[model samples]
Target chain A: MKMPGFDISLVIIWALVAVLVVLAWRRGEGRLQRGLRRGFEMFLINGPRVVVALLAAGFLSYFLPKALIAEWLGHESGWQGILIGSAVGPFFPGGPLVIFPVLVALLKAGAGLPSVFAFLTSASVWGVHRIIMFEIPMMGPRFAAARMIASLALPPLSGLMAVLVIRLLGAPAGVIP
Target chain B: MNALKRKKASLLSEIFGVPFWVFAAISLVMGVLTWQLRGPATVEAAVMGDIDLFLFLVPRMLGGMLIAGLVQVVLPPEVVAKWVGAESGFRGLLIATVVGALTPGGPMTSFPIVVAFYMSGADRGALVAYITAWSLIGFQRFMIWELPLLGPEVALYRVLSVFWMPVLAGFIARRLTIWTAPPPSEEGTR
Candidate 1:
């Protein structure tokens, strides 16, 4: 489970950051300083939340037994598994760093594409924590509510798509145990 | 000056929001649970693992924040408004989708940008598209998180499946607003 790409991506990211920093500097007096200052401010603001969230995710990975997850979300579980995945997604309560590893764990534990797809889609679209924290406060409740209502069908739709893709491509057959 | 004041207020609220408290509480509870279930050694191990992850994440997160800040400073509001504003129509929605997909950072960074666009006269449909696109298939998230974790095949398939969603959601949102608007006569009377 070594991610060879991780190092390469990190290099690319730092390179981009350097370019942006130089560009900001060239933009004229005070602009680069202001941008860096703002960036640092954001880093500080988000630091605590990120730490706790990752800690929680670490605890979750330890707590959720691999065998139980495999039994509940495995390929043979069918649509029921997808439904459960969708239901659990919005309540998972973390960002990509937490969620993706958990998903990987589930996949390793034998969850199929449909369940995984449903879970990811639901979490991304309707994560309750995000809705309450970011969406309602930033976008206003009406906008958030409207978007939520309109996108309500996405999780199941994505799940169905996953099922079709699996059938067409014979995925989850050789991909997972 | 008024806008600056408003921005300060919002920033204050954001710092004190439920997200911080909720996440803290969750972490504490989970830590306790892990201690109970796996004993103190496992809990310590988990904390150490988190510290390792934190070291990896901090640089990337700071870089992301820097990029986001630079973009905000570089891209003129007028340009953003012209591309994704009320006057831009369906093209605005499309542009919004692309911008949202390309934008770096998570919701904490993005939602504020979306609000800035709203203040700059961006269309509701475009805003919807922007948020939807970011949530569903932001390129940064896919490249950094999904591709590495899920592998290329699953990531590609997931992206392909949800590719049209943001555009469709935006269109539907636009139509809903239109349908729910007051009649022209009623508006004149009011």
Candidate 2:
């Protein structure tokens, strides 16, 4: 999915940054100067997350068959569909950046609202990517496993819970997966 | 050069370095432990699912670091601050939320700013909401990549789904008493 027109925001952000850097450079306030340095450091720190999203974007595009997967989940069915949606949600690494769009498409393709919502929330909250990248590194496999068990269950719980809430609040303009 | 090397070496000293490498040992132990202690399918799924995802996700995550660097160099802090630092009510939360959606750098992007916000007396719930909103919504991504693949209806729904999430998150913050995220351990905790 390429929208050259929308790509302008990133380029625009850069241009704006350039202007701000110059303006701050001229003003030369001590606080702003320090902030500029910290800003640079932050860029260094966050640089990789961007790459991860892009790659996840690619992974989702290449590996997953969207409509088929949505159908397999039986998204239009009632409680069972929500169960299926939530169950499949966490394992798929694609974030809402991909999931929601896919969810909307799934809806058009015949998936139901609650199922889509369940999938979106589950995917967002309990993604598999971080289990691999984060859990293994910081906590090691044992703790990671514990967390995963707990986390995996939560996605469905969130969906089911959403039902309890949405049933009460009435899914104002669509709840997420 | 020697002094710089010493600094770098100390930073990567045994205490920090050993644990990182020893993750393999831990993973091995955990695998065996789970294999012995847990059921067959549990161990099998754990081995297949998490490790595969870890393998696939880490390199790209590392790559995401460079994009974050480029974004910072490109967008600077003040612009980020202006865009993200609106008031804490619904509108303010909305601005922060959408900005977070559009901008998709990891913790490294706003964690520092979040620290600053914390130091400057940001509300606890609002900060939580801000971070959540940012990670959940990738506005730039939706516009650039999603619209084309899924078409406008899906894309528009995508936008709308996220549109109120941040605000919802902020309001929900008041209700979620369990988010003991250590009260923004930094100044400017946006």
Candidate 3:
């Protein structure tokens, strides 16, 4: 809930933006204006989608009981939990802001490290929303298809490795909160 | 030139064009269900909570967008492609991975950069590596989001486990591209 790190990160990001804006101004001939305009345009385009997505994520989180999620993704659930996590990843919408928090909640509710990692990997690698909206449209269907096909094994593979590492290192099986 | 190249589309059209509406519809259904199942108070709390999140997100989102713009202006596509073009090989893929990790913004920013690389003769493998690295291992995302939410240990393990993914995906993509490439034409009598 209270993320000091997020606040600090935001400050750093804004500082970087300030430096870049100054540099753009010095670059001469409408560069700064052009860049700002472009940035604003992007914000406008993405803002609505982001709002709807976040609200939806909130509702979804509220609707899905944490106990149920934990049960499905808990440590004792084993490889099945990992599989379910991976399968659910692509369908779990929203950007990092939404996804990470939901994941943290799941972890807090007793989900295993392997399942959490699998969910993160799959969501990042093969998010259906991203693949359809950005990849297919911007990068072409062929490129999207190739990348998806190539990444098909990554979620499970990452989960397997996580499980292996936890066993080998004798680490706690759940997320180390 | 870049200005002309930028696509012009309204927010409404873009939202409707994709499965965004589907997501919205799902959200609406979920909202109604929550209201029915958990009472109106729960729905109100969720909506209010999201509003708080939205306010928190605005500044960060804008900052990210500005950085994305600055990246576009400063790092010319030609320069990016030269460093990660076909001839750059494994080194290119490595550089792409690092670039992708460091490059800021979400898909809206990264995909255009990828398109630029494609036009500038960057290899498909490198492009794939770049996208994969950006999506899977972006340093900014890790530092800002994952560490704060997931904790250091989980984030570290996730990074370690998937660090090799981009290169592997790139390699596979390269092989697939070659396999799918059209066969060389036979010499024919004119």
Candidate 4:
């Protein structure tokens, strides 16, 4: 697969850095060096954890129970499916590449909108691997813990809200998987 | 001289910390499992793919780090504190919600900013709101991924229904932080 080494995202990031550098320069030339040094220190401190986390995520991606999720969510709807979706979200790892396709599969297989929305919400918010690999390492345990607990009810709540939405406006048409 | 050398060694090791070791152990086990269950070829492919991703992320993350570091130096702490500090209240959460939703890119891009803001006197509530907003309602992801894949109707409703999540989460986090032990501003290894 082709890697996006120099994508629009990277360009935007570099642009931000350029602007920040200019800001630092106006503050003082010493601030520029100081900022760069601090950034380098950050890299040294956190880079290894990032590398390990990536490796772990990559290896684990191979084992995601895609078929199992389809089985669990393919036929169910309503609160049960929503509950299942919330439970299953964290286990489905990887980024959009892994997630959206699974969602497409579930929807195509006749999963309900509320369940899928719940799945997406929890997958993004309570991502187990993300917490283990990035959040805990980068942001610390308290922040991670607090964030997790704070957002714990969101998936089901959103799922319930989606039910309300569908009742009022109707479900969107299924994807073309 | 010996003590200095020990301190340097400890710092080097400390940087890796428990998370690194735990992940290293998990990766090792997974590597063994992949080789056994799939094949050596699969293991090789996984490593190469991960390396490519790592390389792709390095530039962006470094840029994020640089911006974060520079912001800490250039932006006044009082400004950050007044805007997003514990005392910043609901309005602080609102600002965080908007900023977080607007922030583009992945965790590598966002987390560094979170660190910088935390160091610069932002409160836990605002920080949590920022992250929640970025995850749940980020415009970039919604436009690029959701609209294209799920179509506009579903995407619109999904967003509309859950738009207030960040502020709610932030509110909860604010109280939770106060109720619990205080989180330090420094980069935590735990």
Candidate 5:
């Protein structure tokens, strides 16, 4: 059976966001609306940039060959998976837009969940955002290195945590195992 | 006129030409691999197809931004000095994480919001952690699309990740100081 609370949760994010926006708007008047509209316009005008980014992401991913990504750094153990996931994962980063559908395809093609989760999380976290915003200007080499080193711990930790949480929640027996 | 053309070219380059090298590098290495629009009418569907996802993401993203802008307004500069502000250390971190996980906007929105918190007196560690957590694990994101597909188990796990990440990031940032407080001056940040 499908879960009941997912929609409720989604609404929570949206509702909170709406409340914040409205409160901000009321206090500031049309200014709030104007800023948001400007942003919306940017999204509209930067249409090509967004498209190219996603398309390029897709094209590059296909070009790189998923198998190669797996073969170079794939691992079975949770710790190893995380380490590999963090290191190799960013090289293949794409936002959820590409990651999920592709992952579903991989699952159908018989990929394991542990690996899938590790890759998906890493895809967003360990990649360019670090370089784009966080690295260089904000955090110099030492800081960047520290963050990356810390992130390296995430994949395996996430894997272990998932298993434990699943077991505790009484995931449908074979749901996790 | 020619000067105008040059200026336009430079501006466009500034806006779009200078790519995120790492992003491109990552994409390229991968591209050598893989791979949003919308609507109702059949023609729109046919023409739009995959673009629907982008369309979907846009409104949600806009919704996020609008909220972020509002958050900026609600928590003004004066009340902040007199009221609840993220100080420093663990307490600051706890506040940051909560803000990060709960706040709805995208990185663009959340990042500025974090700065507002900082100028309002949030600690550096808290700012870093909040930005990291906000962008890294968007709770709203899971609700809309990922949770259904990833299922309860994975969704819960991802949410859990958000809880601890800020903690980890806070501690690390405190020690390193490799962080930025979002710019409170952005009118949106109020």
Candidate 6:
């Protein structure tokens, strides 16, 4: 078991690339060559940044504290818990397979709904790790900075909204299962 | 001497831009620390893993760039502008949010389309909305990962809680861009 690197995503990329190539080919050789050349140049310029960023990401992933999840995000509710959730979200590493189970644990431990909302929102909005490894390298700094600054209010605001919604609907506060 | 130093700095900046150096330094420090503290084996594994990732990235990025370039040539600027341009307003934000949600794959896929649109004259507000929605409500993620792992009740609650984020973020980005003048370089890939 364990192929170490291969995955379905790679297949998806290949399919996508094939489709794009066909699309460009249909357009014309001039446009096709133009796109290919532009894409290569982009890779040349941004490739080093991406490589370094990935290296940094690899090192950073080691330091992510998985054990602290329930401790940090599982207690308290309202503004305090929500604040903690927002703060802790970005620090949690990996995708859904890695993060969701921890989330389920938090729910079982009776973590507050607002805090959970804030945590997920913060993770989605401000996953600084992804910002470094993917967004910054792909999109550039100004775009990243603008988006980051603009979205600063969303996490906690979402948490507050969650509190209101839960109260209005009379939903269970914790323990989903 | 100062003039020479300035020239050298400009050359480096031209090649890599400013953020590259920052990340480079961080990578060096992190790599060294990991090697010492966790032993060389861990560092080796990480390096190899990163190399594998880089290989994967190579094709995806190539395709991504091609899409970006071809889209510009294929799609008329007016169509892009009319839908997602600066003056497209709230409707543009809504359009972007929906598109973002629908977009499949990861950052490699989404960012290219974003750049394509940006170059094609899509507004910053719509771009922000698109990114926000991609990160926040990307339906593929929900369908593939969230529902299976977290269950329906939690997923429903979460959806209810944070659905309004993309539009809000777009509105803010729109207003912010109006106030601040973007640097000439901030325009999408030259």
Q: What global local distance difference test value does model 3 have?
A: 0.74
Off by over 4 Å in 2: A1-72, A94-117, A128-177, B1-74, B82-86, B107-116, B177-190
After superposition, candidate 3 runs with Cα above 4 Å error: A3-6, A90-110, A127-149, A160-177, B1-26, B102-124, B138-160, B174-190
Question: What lDDT score is found at residue B91 in candidate 4?
Answer: 87
TM-score of chain B of 3: 0.62
The per-residue C-alpha lDDT of model 2 at residue A17 equals 51
DockQ of 5: 0.28
- Model 6 spans with C-alpha error above 4 angstroms: A1-76, A172-177, B1-87, B179-190
Clashing pairs in 3: none
Q: Could you estimate the TM-score for every candidate?
A: 0.72, 0.46, 0.72, 0.58, 0.59, 0.56
Worst 10 residues of 6 chain A by lDDT: A1-10
Give the per-residue lDDT of model 3 (tens digit) for A1-177: 332335565776689889989998898678888888877876776667667776676777765566776777877777898899899999876667557757755775667888888888899988999988888888778778878887888888888888887777666534543
Of the true interface contacts, the fraction found in model 1 is 0.57
Q: What lDDT tens digits, residue by residue, belong to model 2 across residues A33-134? A: 554554544333333333333333332232345566456544346677778887777776534444543554455445555566567656764567754654
Candidate 5 C-alpha error for residue B173, in Å: 5.3
Candidate 5, residues B101-154: lDDT per residue as tens digits?
556544445544544564554555565566556556765455434644454455
Candidate 4 differs from the real structure by a C-alpha RMSD in angstroms, to one decimal, of 8.8
TM-scores of chain A, one for each prediction = 0.67, 0.51, 0.64, 0.57, 0.59, 0.56
Please, what are the lDDT tens digits per residue for candidate 3 over residues B1-190?
6555445545447645554676578779989998999999999988887777667667776776677677667666667656665444778778888888877777877788888777656677777789889989996577546644454566667887889899888777777774443212221000
Question: Model 5 chain A, poorest ten-residue lDDT window?
Answer: A1-10
Clashing pairs in 1: none
Residue-by-residue lDDT tens digits, candidate 4, B94-153: 988887886655787778778877766677888888889988887656644565445557
Model 4 residue pairs with clashes: none
List model 5's recovered fraction of native interface contacts, to 2 decimals: 0.24
Question: How many steric overlaps are in each model, in order?
Answer: 0, 29, 0, 0, 27, 0
**lDDT tens digits, residues A25-109, model 5?**
6777576775565444443434444454544433433334456445433333455655555555576533554566555444433
- Please write out the lDDT profile of model 2 over residues B49-168, one tens digit for every residue: 434433443333333333333444455666766645545555666666655554545444555665555455555445545655555555434433443334444444444444455555
- lDDT (C-alpha, whole model) for all candidates: 0.74, 0.49, 0.74, 0.74, 0.51, 0.68
Off by over 4 Å in 1: A1-6, A92-113, A128-146, A160-177, B1-29, B76-78, B86-90, B102-124, B139-158, B175-179, B182-190
Interface RMSD of each: 4.5, 11.7, 4.6, 7.9, 7.0, 9.1
